[model samples]
Each structure stands twice: as C-alpha cells, then as structure tokens.
Target: MSEPSAGDPGALAARLAALPDEQLLAVLVVATAGRDTLAPLYEAATRLLSETGQSGTAPGVIPGTDMPPGYGPSADLGSSSQVDSGIGAVVGDPAATGGTVGGYTAGGVPTFGSLRDKVERRIGTAFGARQLDRQTPAGRGTEEQWEAREQAARERLAQIRTSLHEGEGS
Candidate 1:
C-alpha cells in the first residue's frame, strides 16, 4: 500500500490498528488523562486488556490478592507492631489525648461544615437588617422633593456667584 498523508483518515485508522495491544492501551490511557467524560474509551481499553489476558494491576502484582503493595501473608510485623499499637491507643481515647471528635476540635470548635451555609449566613446578615420597600424605586426621592433639592442647590450657586462678584467690585 502507498504511504498516505497525515490527514488521511484511512491511514490513521490503519496505523492505529497495526499497533500492539499494549501500545493501544498506553495511547488510550494518555488520551483519557484529566478527562472524565470518556467512559466508552475507558471500556474499550479495558476490553482490549482483558482480551489480551492482561490485568489492570501493577506489574508483578497477583491479580486476586487483597493485600496492598509490600504486604503479604508472610510480611514481618516486628517494631512496626509497636507503632501500630500506639496509633490504636491514640485512636481509642480521643478526649484524653486531645484528638478531634466528629470533625470538631478539642476546644469545641467546628472543623466540618458546608461552605454554602456560611455564605448564606453572611448574605442573610448583610441584607436582613434593612428591609427594602419594593414599591419605591431605589436611590430616588419623590418628584417634589427632587425639585426642591435642585432649587436649593441653584440658590446656593447663585449666592456664591453674587459673593464673588461683590468681592471683585471691592
């Protein structure tokens, strides 16, 4: 077959089909990184791995084992058992050891709550004290009151101009 251009869909499909199962899995893993809405792609990769008798576990890990890495049936528990006992003691006595209880501090301060509640409380306190009248337009007075204020400002300006003129004549 002739070499096809990079933009050719047929060529791309052929090249992808020619890749081994491991390479295709790697490609799918890279494509799905930081992306959440690619369930079909994830399923395809899993199907390909299963078809090839490969597992999703790390290399050298037995597939059906429930133990974590570096831990097995014959794993040692020498000095670490003492450390584990100490942690157990601390976890058992929360109040005596000053540990947190139900996500609260030892001093009774709340350490867990939704941020939405706090935001709603702040907004309520800010807008609760002043009850707004829906019938009145905001930042505006009555027409007669506005006219009176404008007239008063005009008289003040006229008085200032008169004083400046009198000072100039003297």
Candidate 2:
C-alpha cells in the first residue's frame, strides 16, 4: 500500500503507536529534544485536523460535537495566541530547560552542535546520522559516498516499482 500522507493525524498516531518500544522511545526523545523545531509540525498537524473537521474525533472516526480524549476544549485552547506564546516560552527561551525551572545561562544558545553533543547524546547513545561532523573533509567524503549509494538504490527501487506496475497492467 502507498504511504499515508503526513497530514493525516490518525495515520501519524497509528504509526507512532505501531513503533517498537525502543523506536517509540527514540521518537519521544527526538520529539522532546527538537520541540522547538517541531512547533511548526505540531501547528500544521492541528491545522490540518481542524480543516478536515476531524480535530476532536478519534483516529479513523468521523468528526462530531463530542470531543475525543485529549481533544476537548480547555481554557488554554481558546486562543492560538496562547498556544503560540506557550510554544515560544518552551522553545524560544533557552532557560526553559526540561523538567527544570529557573535555569537560563548565558551560554544556553540551543545550537545544533550543543543539541547533538548535549541533549541527544544524553537521551541516547547515537542518532540516525552524523550531521555536524559531516562538515569536515573526511566526514563529507563519507557522507557523499553514502548519499551516492543511497541515490543509486532509490533509482533501482523506482525502476523495480515501474516494472511491477507495467507487469500488473499487462
């Protein structure tokens, strides 16, 4: 079957729920770590759901007046401004450390370098790919090699898919 669109919250939630414990934990860590970057993604997901009139419905269910779990209107939910400000407070302010209060430092700039070496590292031993180190000559060579190989593999895979389609048509 074709992949589900990212805008589908039900699909996304299903995918998240289907993940193995380790993978789910990894996703949670990544999500929590990149909460700042993911603000847009969250907004997009919510917007898409609202537009589809499925914001309050359960996954795979049609929209109606009754709100689903965690979907009910709250005092905070009354305004996008509140949500935006809350997200800004959580992400924009470097002092808003996880599970901690009153902890803003001068060196608290949340650069990718710091996040990679500090946040992600503390969350897990490794990540999907080496990003920062990939800038070095040697690292860049390795990354380029991997990318070239990956592109070749994708081309072959696409060709196979086309061939399969043609065979089915015949």
Candidate 3:
C-alpha cells in the first residue's frame, strides 16, 4: 500500500472507507485477535477519525481502552503448584512466614490467594468494559472463552514440541 500524501487526512479516510466492510472487519479481527496486534493501528485510526470530527459518521463504534491497574505491593502472584491445583498447599507457618491464608508456602512465602486475586484482577482488567469495573456474567463468559483459547494454544505448542522431539529421535 502506498503512503498517504502529507497531511491528507481526507485521502486517508477515503482509502479506509474504500475498503470493503469484509476487509475492514478482517483487519479488525486479525489485528484484535489474541493479543491485539493491531490495537495501536486501530486506536490511531479511531483517534484520527475523532480528531477529524468524523467519528459520528464512522461505520461502527470504536472500542474503548481501559487497562486495569495491576495489583499493589501486597498482591499475590500464584506459584506453579497453586496454579495447577487451584489450591495453595501450606509448606510453612503463617506467623513465621507472613503469608496470606490459602497461599502457597515455599521457603516461607505466603502467596496463594493474592495470586489468584491478581489473575482474576487481570482477567477483569483485560476483559472489563471501559464503562464498567465489574464485568457482567456474559463478559465473564467471554473471559472464559479467552482462557480456553489460551489453554488450547499451550496444548498445541506442547504437541508440536513433542512431535519435533520424536521426529529428531526417530
């Protein structure tokens, strides 16, 4: 694609508008797929439209950006075991270790619940609507779908690795 002429916002808009809805939607989908690779482009395009005062006439709404703040100093990040089991196993004393209740205990570190909380928080932050802090049940369902997709990716990667190793060994 050729670059737009300098300061030719109209030309740029025309180019984008010229794209078929399917192409535009494909661009949006591929860009927003998984980790949102096209997020910056999408953001820039939307901002361009808004700055040009043309957003009102844009085809659809531009999604909002609202990254949830991460956990504070006391936020717990779960351990490997805790993540697998969904339960923190006590390996030490709370008084001596200062670990949170239901957290993993390895080398006297108490950090299970906080980790889970952090993950949940991140899930909320990443998936939460800009307009709402607490996501609705349907939104939560979307998050679950994302989780399942992530798991599937991991499984596929593992399978690929195993196949490669077997091929090499054979």
Candidate with the greatest TM-score versus the true structure: 1
| Tens-digit lDDT string for candidate 2 (46-158) | 34444443322222222233433222322121224433233223221222322111111122233332233356455554443455567679999998999999999999999
All models: lDDT? 0.46, 0.43, 0.46
- Model 3: residues with Cα > 4 Å off, grouped in runs: 1-128, 131-134
Q: In candidate 1, where is summed lDDT lowest over 10 consecutive residues?
A: 87-96
TM-score of 3: 0.24
Over 4 Å off in model 1, which ranges? 1-3, 43-170
lDDT of 1 by residue, 1-170 (tens): 86899999998889878887676664563344234587467546645654665433222233343444322222222223424332222211223223322222233343322133356669887676444532356523565577899999999999999999999998
The clash numbers for all candidates, in the given order, read: 0, 0, 3
Relative to the unseen true structure, what is the C-alpha lDDT of residue 153 in candidate 1, on a scale of 0 to 100? Answer: 100
Model 1: lDDT equals 0.46
RMSD of 1: 21.2
In model 1, how many backbone clashes occur? 0
* TM-scores for every predicted model: 0.26, 0.25, 0.24
